[model samples]
Target: MSAIIQIKNVTKEFKVLNRREGLKGSLKDLFSRDYKIVRAVDNISMDIEQGEIVGYLGPNGAGKSTTIKMMTGVLEPTSGEILVGGNIPYQNRAKNAQEIGVVFGQRSQLWWALPLIESFKLLKDIYQISDSDYKSMMHLYQSLVDIEPLLHKPVRQMSLGQRTLSDILAAFLHNPKIVFLDEPTIGLDVSMKSKIRILINALNKEKNTTVILTTHDMGDVDALCRRIVIIDKGKMLYNNDIEHLKGFFGSYRTLKIRMDGDLKQQAEVIQKELPDFSVSADEEWISVLVDEEKSKVMEVLNQLQKSHEIRDMQLEEISTEDVIKKIYEEGVE
Candidate 1:
């Protein structure tokens, strides 16, 4: 599979006005424009293959949004090159628009006063979709989302979840080759989030639609993305498969064991035996934090079984959220 999207050394810079304090200073700044350069996306490069869903993540003020805008031709890059489906996005926006679909979680592209079905019809006309294709898409979308009840309702009168679902349906109505979903599940309830994810997965698998998802939700990344590209402070921090990213910080594991006898005594014994490991206890379980490189879980369990009776045990690995938090706080190692 060849790369469908290629971004090389892309950079986006903006000139932000310097606002002065107080009314007098603010009045003075109106005539004289004092500005500072802000590089929202700095020297980033990545390749996204067709039919792959890549998670684009970062902390607030990161360049995730800037990069997306550039890719969608909303904003032109200051430097470097971007090729989407062999065409420059900024240079060929109209052509690219026909190939790509976009959904902004906080913003709606639908007609505000019109019925949801009317908005979809408007999109179908704009995209020049055929009657057969429209029916096929509606059939597939209806299976994923129960959109019939809300189709006749005005978009402004619908709930957030309903509107979001309608927005997603509109984005894919054209059956574009690539999709950009920015916080598609934001502000949605758990069940709604799950439903959206399932629909996204189905689209990707069934149609081979390439997706670039920008989201703060780890659940979205975990469920839909096998590959992730992480950026912070306008720089690319990590770009790899999900498992490989986990392996970068997979040296530690947590063990929660259920013991038959006194939990505190068991914790104390384990702590004394493995002084290097961190051990704690509650009413029923003894928790041991183990560095797999320094000491193995089997080794600790072997020692514990000799002194105490173990009923059950669970070994856990580090979570994606924890790894991402560490990267944001400490920078990538």
Candidate 2:
């Protein structure tokens, strides 16, 4: 399949004005202000194929929004090229807009006081959707989203789950070839999140719609995306299959030791026994991070047995959150 979206060496820079401290300083700067350039999207490039859901992930201030803005043609890149559906994104924005749909979690494209059905009607017109095609989509959405009950209620009267579901349906009403969803499941219950995921899967399967998802929730990436692109500080860190990311940071293990006696004594004994491992403490809990490939976890347990009585012991794999944190912390040094 041909790539639907192509970004090559894209970089977005912003000139921010410097603010002065004192009242006189602020007054003086009003006439002539100093500006500093900040690169938000730094020389990033990626190719997204048709009908693929790609997870664009990172920590806060990691340029997830800036990249998405450029992809959606909401902002222009300072340098590089982007082609969405064979058209330059910023240069041919109107044509690009007609080919893509976007939904940002914190912002609503729907009218606050209007009923959801009314909002859907307005979108149908805005997108110039044919009457027959609109009815067909509404039928599918009614079954897929279960929006029947809430369609008559005002958006303000709807629950967070209801609003989110409606917002997703609104984005898909036009049946665009591609969609960009930023934090689509934010602030929703588990069941609602599942529903949204199911709906997204259905859209992909039935219509072959390509989706670009930006989210903090690992579960969303795990459930929906086959490939993930991780970024940090406006740079691409990792871009490959989810399994590749897990395997790269999969060398570390989390060991939780439960003590029958005082926590202090147990921690001291473990530290003395395994000096190579990184150790930390909580009130009564003791956590040890050990390199699985280098250190033997069972050897540590055996040593702890001679010193302190063990009530319970558990070993867990480091989560995606921990993996990214470790990468960032190590990069700092």
- Most TM-score-accurate candidate: 2
Candidate 2, 125: how far from true, in Å?
A: 2.0
Worst 10 residues of 2 by lDDT: 324-333
Q: Put down candidate 1 lDDT per residue, 49-142, tens digits, no spaces.
A: 9999999999998999999999998899999999998889999999999999999998988999999889988998999999999999889888
Q: Which candidate is the best by lDDT?
A: 1
TM-score attained by model 2: 0.92
lDDT of 2: 0.85
- In order, the Cα lDDT scores of the candidates are 0.90, 0.85
TM-score of 1: 0.86
Which pairs clash in the backbone of model 2?
none
lDDT of 2 by residue, 231-305 (tens): 888988888987776667547787888876677766776787788887776666788887877767787778777
* Clash number for each model: 0, 0
